[model samples]
Target: MSEPTGVLTLRLAGPLQSWGAASRFARRATERAPTKSGVLGLLAAAQGRDRSADLSDLAALRFAVRLDQPGTRVRDFQTAHHADTGKSMPVSERFYLSDAVFVAAVEGDRDLIGILHAAVRSPVYLPFLGRRSCPPSRPVDLRAHPSGLWKALEAEPWQASTWVQRSRARERRVELEVIADLSAGDGPGDAVRDQPLSFDPRHRRYGLRSVHSRAVTVANPLSAPRRAFVPTQHDPMGLLED
Candidate 1:
């Protein structure tokens, strides 16, 4: 298979994005950065995959993002009162989720693009732009990028920003917009398919790491071009592997 090239843009913004860090209790929450695992979970949902699968395919892909702005952090305190005295008790520490927007771009094999398209079309689970509770304001299709991914995200026509800001006074966060371009090989067979690209283990923490902050054009360095993959009924999940 030949290397493919294209861009995958993700816009993350909402009143809350729970990226569990050191979560211990059923309702336990943590205050930390976004983790790669958490971001992958969102992607899996977009593809409709509820259970974990081999993410090796994504390992080869180059991921980058621009943090439009910083985010606000707030903690919700919980506590119980004395049973005999029935007095007010001290509040326990439960962190409220942070709010921010992320713009990400992925450039790799064309086969990867096909798989992503399929994931969005008939996701195994309810896909969300960032969090399950915060569904995308628009259909998450790259074709909707005539105005660019950043524009699409800003056009969500929802009050997500308002809610995010109102959650906490000290929660003053930043707003960022991203623009990415990708190029991959048009290879044959499934050689590039299901192969893991660069996968971020930190995604479960502070969201996807910001790689290559400065915008740079990507080039495909393959001499022999490969053919793109054609979908088959028996191989519905095969795309995810690529």
Candidate 2:
């Protein structure tokens, strides 16, 4: 008998975020969206799990993210010196998403999902969007959704900021992109290497996971308002008295 399952949704919004699955050397790069490993790591941190802790159970949960407000990508450079040697290290370039918002969801056994929900509300360790430097602007927990992953994402109201929503007020509906784990019997998807194998720093590892992408349109809450009619002032000349 299979265990009953549920989905937990997280609101990942921040002033700056960096989710880099393939970052290396002095050039740390962030993916356009959050990675599965990054989101799972967040839950693990909420539970106060150590880096070396087994992640099989958490890794088994299916993952997905909705790009609510795709923020601007910006870069900065930093130079640091070795503490022990007092020698300057190489200049490093780091990238971040400014003012990005994402709705990340994971589906798993109901019992496990419940525990994660509780952990998120009062996490053992404070949760960050993707890195420690990028703290969430709002509470991360949006509660558990009874529906499935894709449906939950579609049903969730627009999470964009007031200004962002207002910026697109002219539109009646907005299309948001969703990226989710590919399941059996589904069409082919692009492969990514962000699946968590181990968070162990000594020997960190990852596996390939297939992900599918789609878009959902939701009503714009801040749709454009009707323009009020204004009586035109009579021209002083009155068109030269016609």
Candidate 3:
């Protein structure tokens, strides 16, 4: 008999988040959606794993994320000086998504999922959105789901901010995007170089993985009733007085 599997979901929301898969040198870039390697790194951090710790087990978990609120992409410049030499360092350009909210899920063994669920609530190290400076706005752990990745994502309610939810409620139904890993024997989806191999700072490495994207529609909980329109009298002549 084989062990049953479960899904663990996380809410990644903050004022600022930066998930860079290809950042290098003095420039730091971020992907529109959260990366698999980045989410696993967060899990490793929750378990108090070191940078050089073994990640073979964590790498095997299937990953997926839903963009509850695809926030705006913004850039900023940073200036600093080297401490040891007292010399000014090159200005760095960094990009981040402001006011973003995402739902990340990983399907794996039930025991491991349970362990991770506990670790997140009382993480050894506090969880951050994507960078050390950008911490999460809410609790990351959404608990474990009995269903797999897709169902779990679909079942999870919209996690956008109240303002965003109200703005979106104009539509009766809203569609949210989902990006998920392709399993074996699946069709060739888009390939991305964000899979984690090792997190060793000296020699960090990543492999290629295929991901497929789709959208799921959910009824707007804040959908407001349509208001009847009434014409105001003499509004056209009011501009002449100004």
Candidate 4:
């Protein structure tokens, strides 16, 4: 496989994030992590690109997601009446990841990735997690890296919440899970139909994409015992100990 020239990292941290690839009417489901189609859509939205825009260029890029902090799955209920029927509609069962944090990376040419990175930082259209109702809690743009999407995902630090990070700090080693686009020679994984052919709502289309799961270990950045600072005046024994 060819090495990636550039990479764009996105911090997908939100109170309630939904990235459903196979969602149908009245039932919306979410994937464990962000989808490639969803991330591309986000980039396009940031660039103010319309749905009819040709995404072939964007879709060609490799995508990967790091499970920084797997949040709890919550089922939400909502009711919406038909537009023309004007009658009660079935309550939509929307699934979301509450307090989830993921690090998604895209590897591609510098020109394209650079444009996307800029758009992420300064999106023309407001960015949302998946649906418009589920906006990200913080900025999605993490930063840029020089490695490919897979390597970047492996190398990036844990993006979990402060509490989660602190809790993990007690551990001697931290292992993170990552799902990335599988190459020709890579190991096999479950097939998923998420590659977006087009974003046209009228006739949306998708293609099958293969992904493989793997784990990488990183030294805990915060694996240090917590300490409370004591003022010399408050602790006369501190001077004696010194």
Candidate 5:
């Protein structure tokens, strides 16, 4: 089938989201910033796929995130207790947990929309904001542009405004205020469309509160296919090159 296109707006918020990175050792886990792989994995689960698929169609899709109330990173230690042997051992471990909100915007082919809709309704996989496995606070949909999306996001009656900041490494900080005001009637979609999906620091705080914006790309898994029983490296290249 020809490639499908659409946009996905996911709102992520919870007490803790665990995106592991550089974790090795038993009972050891490390939390890293959310990545395209982890987010896609969650989407695939909604589709009932336990394993990753070739979703290359999502590659060209634009990705962006707006973090609301960027939370601090915390690490905890774990120790082992032997019940039968009555022995105690100290074990060191590291991981990350944070309470923050995420707004993700994805734009792509129409087929992608159908998949997302189905995934939301009867998700083969559970949906999560970060790692909290929390159901989306609102329905996910495809809109014309960021303004349309902002409208939908604000429409939620329970929406609250807040200030947020994100650390770009451990040094610099970007600040902004975000407010829930979709009623202002942002112009037609075309004018704001194709804005290269960037986080606006000026609009950082939602109302008087601030939030963090973490943008990521969603890769398409179906763009390239390998020949039957061929060595992986020997597979032909550029079949999808336009």
Candidate 6:
């Protein structure tokens, strides 16, 4: 079986990130990690591909993402009054993740991957999370991986923030989950409702796609720190006195 020789790796970390799967009116939700559509849309923005442009080619690339850190979910209430109607609008709950991080990989033709990587480095149009309101906090481009999506995602180091990394590094090892696009013979995975049909705002559409998930335990991806935290299960010394 032939596969793309290169995969584009990206660090999707930011103060606030949101990837909506099934958001309804007055209630905006988000996925734990970046979605295929969201990532691909970022690429398109890098290449300056308009919303009406052809996405079939970009969508063909194999997609995968590893959850380095599942940020905390926060909700904000939004209130507005209708333009025509003189009634106050319902309070909308907008959700966002704070200090989230993810390593997203796209496997495709080497040349294509290279181009996408460059686009990310210097995007033609600004790249946002899932919505324009949630802009990325840091650079999105990591580098190009000359391997399969799974290998790249697994090999890449944890992308959590420094403080978060230190907190987890005290444990010395962390288990991360990987979700990748699949057809058959790739083991069992959940079908996600993120496959993009059309990104048209007027007629947005979505479909289901298969994704396999697996846990990978790796040594603390962060390097040596000044101090390591030791969280013991039992209070050997009984430091807390009644």
Which of the numbered candidates is closest to the native, going by highest lDDT? Answer: 2
**Tens digit per residue, CA lDDT, model 4, 126-152:** 899988988988888888887666667
Model 5: per-residue lDDT, tens digit, 1-242? Answer: 75544456666566656555334575445333444444555666677653434445443454444443455677677677888997887686655556655555555565775666567666765677545533444444323332333443333222112322212222132332332212234332212112112123343111111223322222222223334775566536668667
lDDT of each: 0.46, 0.93, 0.92, 0.86, 0.45, 0.84
lDDT (tens digit, per residue) of candidate 1 on 71-170: 6666666778899999977665665445655444444566675676567666677655333545654344432233233344443332234444344334
Residue 149 lDDT (model 1)? 34
lDDT of 4 at 200: 92
TM-score of each prediction: 0.47, 0.91, 0.90, 0.88, 0.49, 0.85
Pairs clashing in candidate 3?
none
Ranked candidates (TM-score, high to low): 2, 3, 4, 6, 5, 1
Candidate 1 least-lDDT 10 residues: 186-195
Which scores greater on lDDT, model 1 or model 6?
Answer: 6
lDDT of 6 by residue, 1-242 (tens): 77447999988888889898889999999887889999998899899987888788788888988888888998889899989987999899999988888888888888888888889888899889888888888888888988777778768877777887777655677889877897679777788888887888788888898988877665686646557788879976788666
RMSD of each: 21.5, 2.9, 5.3, 5.9, 23.3, 6.4
lDDT of 6: 0.84
The segments of candidate 2 whose C-alpha lies over 4 angstroms from its true place after superposition are 225-242
- The window of 10 residues in a row where model 4 has the poorest summed lDDT is 230-239
Per-residue error for 177 in candidate 2, Å, reads: 0.4
Best-first order by lDDT: 2, 3, 4, 6, 1, 5
**Most TM-score-accurate candidate:** 2
Model 5 weakest 10-residue run by lDDT:
190-199
Error of 2 at 81 (Å): 1.6
Cα deviation of 206 in candidate 5 (Å)? 34
lDDT tens digits by residue: candidate 3, 62-165: 99999999999999999999899989999999999999999999999999999889999999999987799899999999979985788898788888888888
